[model samples]
Target: MRILLVDDHAIVRTGLRKLLAMVSNAEILEAKTGRESLAIAKAQPLDMIILDLNLPELGGLELLSRLRQFGPAPILVLSMHSEPIYVTRALEAGAQGYMSKNASPDELLTAIRQVSGGGRYIEQEIAQALILQSAVPAASLAQLAPRDLEILRHLAAGRSLSEIAEALGLGYKTIANNCSLIKTKLGVTKTADLLRLALEAGVS
Candidate 1:
């Protein structure tokens, strides 16, 4: 099997290459950013992709969407954040599997094989959490107001507050006030933290 690994950290790529070496006869290709990964993917045939969610240039999720435009190769999201929300969003965005960086070697191997073989893979704990969340009635979207929801969604998509305000035709102070209300309702301390939580929850 051939796999492409995309991450900004060379150490992570090296470590994953070593681990993968122990289990399968896989040909590995590495790229340090989303643009490089896309270039490599377009130039070569790959059975699967191991992608890190937090990237320097284009984010893993955005890259996943772009990759889907070209082909249907299974993507296994390897993220440091284990929140079920993030896992769910990746899957929703066309990822075949979601696994954390903290996973054991065996777990990583299993996920790679599972995804490469056309199967879905998610950690058991995350799966259970998703199930529980599904059972609960989702909060009404009206609670936050449409404008606030729009700002939150842009934030979830990695837009800065200034960018969000400009995009939405709102004043900076107005957007900032809406953001404060969002934080109060969501119980988030900072905008970045709130965005992370929103991503994990698949809000956008």
Candidate 2:
């Protein structure tokens, strides 16, 4: 199996390398930045990619998007951020599985194997969080894209569109478009109702 590990820390990569060695006849490659990971991913076909959400040079989600464009390969996220929002973002960004750093080594291997075998995996805690969010019938999380969810959170936190655009390093027009999409998806034509939905989703 050819597996590419994407993480910024030498120590984390070292640990992951040892754990992934459990794969039968595994050939592992390492990258310390999102850009580096994207370059390697484009260079060859990988059986799997284990990535961390946080990275330098390029954002991990953006890197995941770029890698997905190359074609299908299991991309498992190993990260410290285990919240539902983060998990949702990772899944929406094309991660095949999400494993929190707090998970047992056994779970780590299990998630890797499952995703490599063309299955999806999400941590139990994250699953429960999503389920809890689903208790509200209106403003379904499914309607929002990852980026939309992010903007929703910002809006719920009392950020203006200009502030959100500056905070996310995006154009004001882009942020406005995303906000409009969020409203359309959530079936809320009013900004106040959108904020209420965001709050209901526990974004605030």
Regions more than 4 Å wrong, model 1: 134-204
Q: Candidate 2 residues 79-195, lDDT tens each?
A: 876656667767877999998899899888889889999999987877777777565633376566556666776787788999988866789999999888877887879999888
- The digit string of per-residue lDDT tens for model 1 on 1-204 reads 788999999999999999989887789999998889999889877888999977655666677878777677899999886655456557877999988887787888898889999999997666776777742213423245435545766787778878977766668898898898888887777878777655545566
Q: Report the CA-based lDDT of candidate 2 relative to the real structure.
A: 0.80
lDDT of each: 0.77, 0.80
In Å, residue 126's CA in model 1 sits off its true spot by 1.5
Regions of model 2 farther than 4 Å from truth: 134-204
| Backbone-clash count (model 1) | 2
